[model samples]
Target: MKLDIQHETHYEYSAPLRYSTQSLRLTPQPSAHQTVLRWALQVPGKLFAQRDGYGNEAHTWTLARRLWRGAIHAAGLVETHASPWLVDAPALPSPLLYLRPTALTPFDRQLLNIGAQALDGAPAERNLLALARLVRERVAYRHGVTDVMTSAVDALDIGAGVCQDQAHVFIAACRARGVPARYVSGYFYAPDSPALASHAWADVCIDIPGRLWLSVDVTHGCVMDDRHVRLAVGPDYAACLPIRGVRHGGGEEAMRVSVQIRPAAP
Candidate 1:
């Protein structure tokens, strides 16, 4: 399936900023399950292209002039294959690296309990799906209740969160049981569910020796399919954020994001 995606992120600041720099992980890389047909980024400053620590196609955008508003636009055409699992080509970071805990995915007693219940059986694909389902049931999908800084434990405690939160909880649960799991940021082509267009999911290492990963959409409690266009993978959302930056003097900032995904014209 070919998908044309248009993403726009705009920021407005109460005070002008003297300098700003951002790391962008908005570009998608070709894999066994997806191919990037065409991609581009439009921003105010020059974008320095480089590969991030996780081997994600990344860019650094820097603006030295004073500004009160900024915008970033990313447009791309990608073709995704219908694959139940993603096999990572032999890469730098080993699967064991993902098992390590991060600030957003710290170990917790409640998360361990959840994992213990869902993973009572063998660590098969079905059991992983059950773990995702359990997360979805405990954490109801509700907006405005959680922020990007919310951790897995915090979201589990609140009992409500967005896709990111759910993914974090699922990752923590998997890691608690000595499973290698990582966070994935991507676009889900669901016209009826616009909010899901900008989505987050999890990738569990089912066969570490074979470098096979099972991509799970915890929010929907299913494996990823052709409709999912993966952007970046990391230990947590902070590492895979589409745009993360710091400014010198911007105060009281407000941000708005727009994402549109549709079938490409032949």
Candidate 2:
């Protein structure tokens, strides 16, 4: 399957800024599942190609002069030759590198305890699926109840959150059980639902028969497929966020995003 993607973001500020800069992880990385046929980034200023630590192809955008309103757009075509198997083998040094606890994905005793109990002698792959399903059932999908600062424990406590929260909780839960997990940011091709175009999911490195990274959508309780176009991966969302920016002299800024993923005509 092939998908044509459009991810556009607009920033409106009340006042002009001396300069604005953004690091974009908008380009998808090469993996066994999919390959990038062609891609480009549309920005108000200049964009330079940069490689992130996680081996993702990122771009740096800069509007070095005064600018009040600007839009950053990413348009691309990715062909998905996905596998239905529950395993994804990427060329990473070691899965243990992702086990370190971060502020957004702190390991909790209760969460860890739940993970251990849920496994119940099941293989790590099976355990990850069960845990992801349990998280989706536990945390209702709702927006505006959480923010970037909300930790996995906090989201679990609230009992509701967006995809980010679900992914974080799932990552923490897996990590708590000593399973190496990472966070992923991507786009879901929901033909009927545009809201799912910008999505988040978690990946866990499991070693039962062999080592493989499995992508799990905790919010939807399923393994990822062709509809999922991965953008970036890291220990957490903070590292793989699509857009990370810092601006000067802009007061009370507002942001809006639009994403569309559709089948390419052939």
Candidate 3:
């Protein structure tokens, strides 16, 4: 399937910013399941491109002048192929690196118990799928109940959060069970669910030696397929944020994001 995607992010600041620098992980790389036909980024700054530690294409955007408002636009055309739930790719950074807990994916006794209960004596894939389902069940999907700063344990306690929270919980549970899992930030083409266009998921390393991964959409209780477009992977959302920045000023900042994904003309 071919998809045309457009993402727009606008920020308004109460005060002018003296200087600003942003890290962008909005570009997707060509992989076994997807091919990037055309992609571009538009921002009011000097942009430099480089590969991040996770082997993901990253860009650094810098604005030296003072500004009170700014906008970022990313447009692309990608072709995705249908494949099994498993993601087969070379492990650039060892999968073991994902086992370490991050601020967003910290595991406690609750998470350990959840993992033990869900993955009891099941096959690798089955156990991971069960874990995903259990996470979804524990954390109901609801907006406005959580924010980007919410951790997996906090979201689990709140019992409601968006895809990001669900993915974090799933990652925490997987790592608690001695399974290596990483967070994936991407786009999901779901016409019925417009808000889900900007999506997050978890990728579990099912076969460490073979470097095989199972990409599970914990929010949807299923594995990733052609409908998903990969962006970047890291220990947590903070590591692979679509856009993160720091500014000298820009007090009381407000941000708005819009994402659209559609089938492209043949």
Per-candidate TM vs. native?
A: 0.96, 0.92, 0.95
Separately for all candidates shown, the number of backbone clashes (residues 3 or more apart, or on different chains) is 0, 0, 0
Indicate the residue-level lDDT of 130 in model 1: 92
Ranking by lDDT: 1, 3, 2
Worst 10 residues of 1 by lDDT: 83-92
List model 2 lDDT by residue over 24-124, tens digit each. 99988667778889888889987899777777789887787877888888899998876423343455446787888899999798678657766565335
Q: What residue runs in model 2 are displaced by over 4 Å at the alpha carbon? A: 84-93, 120-123, 208-211
Which clashing pairs does model 3 show? none
Task: Choose 1 or 3, whichever is better by TM-score.
Answer: 1
Worst 10 residues of 2 by lDDT: 84-93
Candidate number with the higher TM-score (1 or 2): 1
lDDT of each: 0.92, 0.82, 0.89
**What are the per-residue Cα lDDT tens digits for candidate 1 across 197-229?**
999999998888888888999998889899999
Ranking by TM-score: 1, 3, 2
Q: What overall lDDT, based on C-alpha atoms, would model 3 receive against the true structure?
A: 0.89
* Top of the candidates by TM-score: 1
lDDT agreement of model 1 with the native = 0.92
Listed per candidate, the RMSD to the true structure in angstroms reads 1.3, 2.2, 1.7
